[model samples]
Target: MVRSNAYDLPTISVQGEIDHPRLRSLGFVDPSGHAQLVALGTSGIAYDVRIGDRAVGWAADHVEPGVSIRHSDVEANLALAYNSCVGNRAIVVSGRAQGAEGVVTGKHGGALPTDRLLVDFSPDVLDKLVIGDSILIRSRGQGLVLPDHPGVSVRNLDPNLLDRLPISEVGGVLSVGVAARIPARVMGSGIGMGSVALGDYDINLFDAQTVEEFGLDRLRLGDLVHLEDTDNRFGRSYRKGMSTIAVVAHSDSVLAGHGPGVVTLFSGSDEDLVAVDDPAANLADIWRV
Candidate 1:
């Protein structure tokens, strides 16, 4: 069995409020040079979008599924984004939806407007939510380590979720099931970020052929994706024989170099970590959120 230092980790409380969605004053221009003005970024509560929904073809740019939040203070917001792990429990502490429970579904590194955390909630709870509502998350799992597989680094994934992943180790190689494999070359925005725990990079879908070739057009919000020839240990970059595992946290974008946002979950050398295709390999299915 795969083991980690999960039992020894500390789970802290981090608080944030529903963030206000904002669009650029003049809007943005697409790759086709078309200026578009639409709903974009950080909606307090998304009633229709859920974990298993499609990530592409949204009328929005960098759309975050479920509820989005941020701390009013810059430093605190940074902590909220960096510390909260996917699968962490989030509870509403204020507003009409007080006491409502949700799951931390994804995190977006300030790709466009601001950095935010995505939380999935029931439709009834969403109906009662409002902007500025406070949420408290029990944050943990940032420094998770696979003791038997030191080469594989775990980040931004909850220990509980990690325990549930279909992971197996044999002959010095760790195999994980993923919904899809993303080519490293198709990666865009947030590529040069110095840290993976703070935010997620985008999957560039500007090239229709590449998107189709990789079957990315049907990507879902909580899908587990494998990044081929990708490295995120120190920073985001391409290293031969290395791969990274990430979860789709946000929606598709019309902006150049910006598509669905994905937060890193695991990364290691190809020799030590391997991915097996399993169409059912997604957070929505695994976590049952």
Candidate 2:
């Protein structure tokens, strides 16, 4: 994995330029009942059709809630070896079915996907696997960069709340920035859901009622939302000048290779977020005092 300065937020960078004469779409299904083409990351091909600001759920090709398969499901000729692994692809480097392969899957709890890609391994191989084992990933997509926008900022976040954010009932849906113009989707997993506080957010797709009530239908990808920042370490507060902001990027969990939606602390400190009615306000405009 690439590393940056501690103060400099981490981001992905592409190794080479892609100059395909004719690009194709991923034909991904969004949570809002729409079919759209999507980029795996900022480095991949850019799409033409834009979606609304509502948070939509997305996944790497072939990922589901309870579906497990072998790495051969996606790749046919994967080699099995110790530490000769790829980043997001899955390979059965060791065990009874030592040669079997799986998708790189993702990282959460104590287990992480071999490559940034999801790996599918046979149940037999999975059962014999132990912690500290290595897998492989055939990394794709363009490089990602931590966006540099005043509307977005980051701080030490409460892990518990990150895990508790609601999930969208509709496919590929998530609640994003306050504006209604940005277009982005959610994807992936291991965003510390089920775990709280060590720097995770339970980001989920907002329901229809909340989406309408908050005028979320107007939001677009890349729009920044100034979350009601607060000092309360345990719960949420909606006060003026007491909120932080995050940008709506992909519609995926923060864990694994998927990018997490972010709220930066550019204007205020952790304590600056207080209580208020509009929790997702662009405070930079109203709170600049």
Candidate 3:
């Protein structure tokens, strides 16, 4: 018999907010001719699109007709650890294609899916990807786990703003880092929003204007947000002093039930963090001892 919670289990909590006054003006309307106040489903979340070697901000899928999901204020993934791997190498661990390898385009976030390390292969290679298949990432930069450093923290972020912010780079690399820790209680609707109940948290990356205007820019993509240890049932706190780590990716995706970018990693119990004002600080400077 197939066991449930085997792969991609849900372990987070989500709440809805009804303060979107501009949603209707943007053409979102209900059947009553008023601004449609639909519950932002798990489709509104998204991840930063990495085209070549750039973080292209956040992009969500269709929410309503004519209301295309644009790059809004959102947070990027934080808590990144560099592994020992070269570029363009593939490492397949899970799924039916276990032992199969793909090309490593580059690393984006700290973890795997949440910190989505981009891997490119032929269409035939992608065809082998299964739902429960775990990717064995290999390279000179592999298995670099996020340290429970006291200087790091994260908060709930908005995705819309992440799509608009200008790109920042360091040593020709994208300059992204975590700002603070956020409880899973603040995550909203999107594909992984359902996965939140599975002990995962979505990352946001945007600007402040988007936060006040559409609440999108409040976060950026690379923010290292924290997930409170809690029971998926009743959405109650489980480990009073424990938590997990995930990087914000996006709100939705082109594939069904596969929106947003998430990379999950096992964290220790006493991983404390603090907030920083500028998230775009150079990685070398911030992580410097």
Candidate 4:
């Protein structure tokens, strides 16, 4: 397993809650210029549903505001964002859900002032978790490195999660198991970001033809998906002969230029990533989460 040289990274604590931001107009125009009012972003209990649950929905399935934390301390929030990675351990330090543990599933940026970081807790504990609860993160996924593959870049992923992934070195090449293969041309929204460690990108499911062709409708919330012809090293951009492996963070959205969200695990170029199919190719299954 890949481990950081410096094992003394400081554990940082940042608190957030379910934010009920007032919207003058909940109505939004879809990609087809159709009006929609879908409830999304933070709070409420999302049940044991998986991806592809509600292909036609006004809300993001299986992802709600368990706790949202960001403050005027932009630098500090950014640091917390950078330190916390997918699959890291998170404990409810305060509130009724105190001592309960969960996993960091994904992160959202610029969406809300305080709801930047998005985490996932089991349904049983969600009710106990209220807004403004203290969340202590055991942040330790920053210094991960693929010692063998110098070209691939890793971000917002725990090394332990990486180990559980079915990535293997066979015949001097790495094979990554993915639930589905998506085309880079379909990638929309949240691109050109300097770092995915702080946020995630979305796969626009607005095109009916593309969704049917790629089998994206079967994606699960934590499924590991492969995006062909995409490079997210410096920014989310289309690059031929490049591919990125990411985990689905959120559910499908009816909003314009938005769909299921995905955070980058690592990216490789020159056709180094080989896509293989596996039904259990998801974070929840990997760690038995």
* TM-scores of all candidate predictions against the true structure: 0.96, 0.30, 0.32, 0.87
Give the runs in model 1 whose Cα sits over 4 Å from its true position.
111-113
What are the clashing pairs of model 1? none
Q: TM-score winner among the candidates?
A: 1
Error of 1 at 68 (Å): 0.3
Q: How close is candidate 3 to the true structure, as a TM-score?
A: 0.32
Candidate 3 per-residue C-alpha lDDT over 67-94 given as tens digits, one digit per residue, 9 for 90 to 100:
0111121231121112312132345555
RMSD of 3: 15.2
Candidate 2, 1-289: lDDT as tens digits: 1111233323221111111222356565555566766544321122321222233434332111111222222122122111111122334454344555543212111122121122334445545654334333333211212232222232322222222222121222122234422112221233323321111122333344544555554543333454443321222233343444443433333233333333222223434222233333332222121
Error of 4 at 151 (Å): 1.4
Candidate 4: which stretches are off by over 4 Å? Answer: 1-24, 43-72, 110-115
Each model's Cα RMSD: 1.5, 16.6, 15.2, 2.9
Candidate 4: TM-score? Answer: 0.87
lDDT of 4 at 253: 73
RMSD of 4: 2.9
Q: Which stretches of candidate 3 lie over 4 Å from their true place?
A: 1-48, 51-59, 62-177, 188-216, 228-238, 252-261, 270-278, 281-289
Ranking by TM-score: 1, 4, 3, 2
Backbone clashes, each candidate = 0, 89, 97, 4
What do the candidate models score in CA lDDT, each in turn?
Answer: 0.88, 0.30, 0.30, 0.69
